[model samples]
Target: MKGKVLSLGAAALLAGGALLLTGTANQSNAQDLLGVSFIDNVKPYLEFRPRYEYVDQEKTGKKDANALTIRTKIGVNIGTVLGVQGLSATLEAIDVSALIDQYDPQRTKYETVKDPANTRITQAYLAYKYSNFVFIAGRKYVAIDDHRFIGTVNWRQMPQSLGVVAVAGKPIQGLDFLLAGVYERKGIVDSLNKDWKMDKMPIVLDVNYQVVPQALRLKGFAYLLTDIHNTYGIKASGKIGLGNGVTVSYLGEYAKQTDPYQKDNVATKPDIDTDYYRLKVGASAMGFFGNVMYTYFGNAGGKDAGFSTPLATLHKFDGWADVMLSGAAKGFYYGMKEWCISAGYKNPVIGKLMIAYLKFDSDKDPGFGKSIGSEVDLLYAKKLTKRLSFLAKAAYYNADNGYCISECNNKEDALGKNDVTKYWLQLDYKY
Candidate 1:
C-alpha cells in the first residue's frame, strides 16, 4: 500500500508538471499546440500532511494504538472552459498511507484508530455561476450550519464527500440560501463500506440572514434523508462589542428529528422522534478567549434511540476524545446531555494554546447512574512558514463507573474503569 501510494503521488506530480508546461507553451499562441484554448484558467494545488497518533485505553488485554500516517492530495481547477463564462471544473485525488500500521482501521486486526490506508478521487465536479447564483454537480464536499448535522468530516485522513446536485445564491439582501439533493455519500470509511448509496432522495436546504450585519445572524435548515430521517432546525448567533478590547458572542440552536418515508417498514428500529438543542456564550479580550456551551439530545419517550446525527462531522462536536461521536444517547434509556467550557490564548511568540473541559450525563435515570464521564483537551498550533504548520494535541477522558457498563458498547470504547488518553503530533504543508 505504501509503495502504491508513493507511485501514484509521483505520477500525479508529473501530470501536474506536464499541464503547467503545456499551459506555458500555449501562452505564445491563442490556442495550445494540442488545439486547446489558452484562455482556460487553471490552478493547481498540493497538500501533504504527516501525523503520529497514540492512544491508551484501560481495557485489559486491549493493546494500545500507535500510528504513523501521511496524507497527500493533488488537484487542479479549470475555469472559463470552452469560452463559456461561469463554467468551471475541478478534479482532485487523495491518498493516505500508513508508515507504521500499528492501529486497526476496522478492516485489520490491530487496535482501532479509524484512519485507514486508501486512495481515491476525493473531489470531481463541474460548476456554473451567473450573477449571484452558483450550480454544482458531481462529487464534492458539503457542510451546513456549523456542521452539527452535516459536514465534510475533513478532520480525518479520508474526510467525506457527497454525490449531489447543489445550488447556492444570495436571492435577496442579507440573505443567503443553499439547496442540494444528495444521491450518495462517500464516508471516511469508504475503503471499508464503499459509498453509502442512498435509495431515496436526500435533500438539504440552508438559509442564513444577517439581521444586523456582524452583530446578529439568523439561520435555518431542513435535511431530509429519505427512508431514514428528517431534520429541521433554526439557529441564531451574534457578537457584540463591549467597548475596550472585549467582545461577547452568543449562539442558540434547536432542531427536531422525525422518521422519513415508510416509517412503519423498519419496526425493529426505534421511531425517530427527538429534539436537539445547543446554547453557547463566550467573551474575548486581548489575546484571551473563553466560552461555555451546553448541548442536549432529547429522549424519545425514554427509548434508547435518541437524536442521531448520522451525517454530522461527529469528531468536531463531541469531545475530541470522540467518545460521543456516535450520538450520546447510545446505551442509556434516556437521551444525553453535555456541558463544555473552554479557554484559549494566542500570541505571536507562542502561537496558540487552547484547553477545554467537558462533562457528560444522561438526561434521565438509567438505573446505574446519570453521570457518564468527563474529558480534558489541550492543543497547541504554530505556523512555521507560509505553507507549513505544526500541531500538538491531547485528550484525556475519565470515565465514571457507569460509563463502562452502559456507554462502552464496543471494545474500542475509551470508557472503562481507568482513564483513556490520546496524543497527536502533526505537520502540514499546503501549496
Candidate 2:
C-alpha cells in the first residue's frame, strides 16, 4: 500500500517538473537555460547521516543488539512558482538503509532501535507569502514550540511529517500565531503499522506573545485530535540578567487533556480527564549551564486514561531511555512523575558537552512499589566543518525496584524494567 502511494506521489512531482520545463521554453527571463528562461531560481540540497547504535538489556535473556544505518535526503527549493511572485515550493525525498540489522524495529524479541529500512517522500510543500503572513499547503514538517505537543521526531532515522494546510502570521507587534488543519500523520514507522492514522483529522492553534523584550513570554495552544483526545495548554517563560555575563531562565507550563469530539458517533472512545505540568529553572554563565526540571502526568485510573503526548517528540522529555514514553498510557496505569538535573559546557573549540540525571516514579502505587527507575545521559557534539558534524551520546537506566505489578510474580522484566544501556556514534553532512 505504501509503495503504491509513494509511486503516485512521485509521478505527480515528475509531471509538475515537466510542466515547469515546458513553461520555461516559452518564457524568457534573466537567468536562462540554453538561451531560454527557466522560472526564477532553483536551489538544491543534499544531506547524509550514518549512525551506529548499540543496545544492551540486563535480563531480557536475548542477545545484545547492534544496528548500523544510513539516512540520505535530496531536495530542491523553487524560488518562484512558475513566475508567481509570492509563490514558492519545496520537494524532498528521504531514504534509510541498514547494514547491520540485528535489533528489532518493534519492541518484541530483541532490544528495540526503531530505525527500519525505508524510503518515502519526506517533504513537499507550496507556500505563498504576502506581507507578514504565509500560507502553506502539502506534506511537510510541522513543529511547535519546544516540541512538547507536536513535532518532527528528528531523533529517528525517519522523521515524522504531516499533511497539513496552515496559515501563520504576525498581526501585531511581538505577537505570532499559527492555525492549521492536519489530515495525515506520516510517522517514523511504516504505514502498515497504522502509523498513518487518517481516520479523523486534527486541528491545531498556537499563539505566542512577547510580554517583555527579553524578560517574559507567553504561549497558548490547542490540539484537537478527533476521535482520540484533546489538549489545551498555556506556557510562560522568562529570562533574567544577573550581573557579569550571567543569566537565569525559568519556565512553567500546565495543560489539560480530555475526551475528544468525535467526527462521527460510530463507537465510543475511552474517557480521559488528566492534567500535565512542567517546571524548570536554569542558569548560564561563561559558556557553562545548569538546569533543574520537574514534570508530572496526572493519573486517571479505572476505565479512564492519563495525559499522553502522542504527537510529541517523546524521546526528548522523560528520559533518553524512553521508558516513560508509554508509562502514562497503559504500561503503568498510574501515570508518571520525573525529576531531572543537568549541567553542560560549550566552547568554540571543545564544542558542547552535557550530562543529565533523571529519577522516575509513578504518581500512584498500583500494588507494587512506586519506584520506576533512574537514568544517566551523556552527550558530546562537535562541528568538524561548516557542513559536517560529529556526535556521541549514551544513556544508562537502572530500574530501582523493577517496573512490575502483581500480575508478573517473579518475571520483573515482563514490564521491560531491566537495566538498559544504549549508545550511538554518528556523523552528519549537508551541502
Candidate 3:
C-alpha cells in the first residue's frame, strides 16, 4: 500500500527527531529520570492537502468525475505523561493519495476517485486532566453540536474516526459536560470497506451552558445507537451586539428519533419515528456575513424510517449536491427538507468570499413529487502564507421535476434529466 505509506512516513520523521532530540538533551536531568516531562512535552503535527475534484451528473452518458487528491497528516503530542499530572498522549496518521483517479470511491470498481488511497490510524488517544475533569481513551476525533449528530468527516479524504470512551466536565459557572462511549466506526469509506466498520455500542450525551459568555448558549444532546436508533437534542445559540458595527446571530435546533433498545428488526425493518429542526439567522458587520437557514427532516416514522444522521458531517448538511446525503431517498422512503441562504465576505486584500442558496423538499408523500432540488454554492478562500491555504469551490444542482419524481423511478427515462455540477480546487499546508 504505497510502501506502507512510505514506511509510515519514515516513522513519523523519525519520531519527530526523537522528540526534538530528547527534549533538547534532557533540559535538565529528564525530570528525575523520566517521571514525565519527557522531550519537553512533545508536540509535532503536520498536514498537507491537495485536492481537485469535479463531477457533473444528470445521468445520461454517465462519465464525469475527475479527481486528483492528496492528503497527509502526521502527529504527536504528549504532555505531562509518566509523572502523570493530568497525563496526555496522542498519535495521528492518515494518508490518502490519488493523483488522478477519475472518480468512484464508492468503494470498489477500482478507480472512481472517492479519494481512496488509504493508510489509516487517524488518531490514538489517552488523556486525563483534573480540576473540572477530562478523560479520553483510544481512537479519536469526534464532534457534536454543529456536526449535527456527530462528526469528524473532516470534509472527506479520509476523516472519520471513533472507537471511543470519553468524558468531560465543568462543575460550575457556565456548565459544560460530555460523556461518550462508542465501539467502532471508521468510515469515510473505511478505506474501501472493511465492511466500512461499525460495531455499535453507542452512547453519548453532551450539555453546554454559557448563558452569556459569547452572548448566550445552551445545548443538550443524547445519542444511544445500540439496537439502531435514538437521538435526542436541543440547542440554542446566540450572539448579539448591535451598534454601528452590527452583529446578530442565532441558531435553534431540536431533535428526536427513536427505537433504540425498544428494538424490532426483521432484518432491516426500521422505523425509528422522527423529527428534527434547525433554524438560523445571522448578520455581521464590516467584513460582511449573512445567513438564513431552515432544515427539517421529519417523516413521522413512515416508509421504513426518515430522520437520520448516520454520523453527521454529511458534507456539511444538505446542499453540496451530495444530493441530500441520504435524506431524499425514494425506495424505502426517506425525508428531506431544507432551505438556506448565505453570504459572506472577508477581505484582507480580497481574500474570502462565499455565497450559498439551497432548497430541497420532500418529507414524506413519496408517491413522487415534492420538488427536490435547487442549489448554488460558491466559495473562495486564500491565505497563501503562514501555513499556506487556498481553496475554490462550487456546486450547482437544479434537479426538480420533483427531482425526477422523487429520484428517478425506474431510471426515469435513463436518469432523470441531469443537472448537478461540482468543482473544487484546494491546497493547504500546516505544521
TM-score of each: 0.89, 0.88, 0.36
| Sort order, lDDT high to low | 2, 1, 3
Please give, for residues 307-362, the per-residue lDDT of candidate 1 as tens digits: 77777788887688877665542422356788999999988778999999999886
lDDT-superior candidate, 2 or 3: 2
Candidate 2 global TM-score: 0.88
Residues 23-140, candidate 2, lDDT per residue (tens digit)? 5434543335334333357666778899999999886687787999888776778787756788888888888877788888633467778788887888889999999999999899
Off by over 4 Å in 2: 1-39, 106-109, 191-200, 263-266, 328-332, 401-416
| Tens digit per residue, CA lDDT, model 3, 1-431 | 47766866765654344446554454446656765455336787788898998887764465787788888888878775656778777878888888787777633433234567888877878889988888898888898767877889798878988878788889898998888877677878753222112344577888999988778899888887665578888888988898999999999989887776433223552556777888999998999998999988776444356667777887887777576665532211345678899898998778999889988776655455666668899999999888988989898988864432122343252222358788889898998
Residue 361 in model 2: lDDT: 81
Query: Of the candidates shown, which would achieve the greatest lDDT relative to the real structure?
Result: 2
Model 3 whole-model lDDT (C-alpha atoms) = 0.73
Candidate 2, pairs of clashing residues:
none
lDDT (Cα atoms) of all candidates against the true structure? 0.77, 0.78, 0.73
**Model 3 misplacement above 4 A:** 1-84, 104-128, 135-140, 145-147, 154-156, 160-167, 170-205, 208-295, 298-311, 315-321, 326-431
Show model 1 residue runs off by greater than 4 Å: 1-18, 23-39, 106-109, 191-199, 262-270, 302-304, 328-333, 401-418
- Against the true structure, candidate 3 reaches a TM-score of 0.36
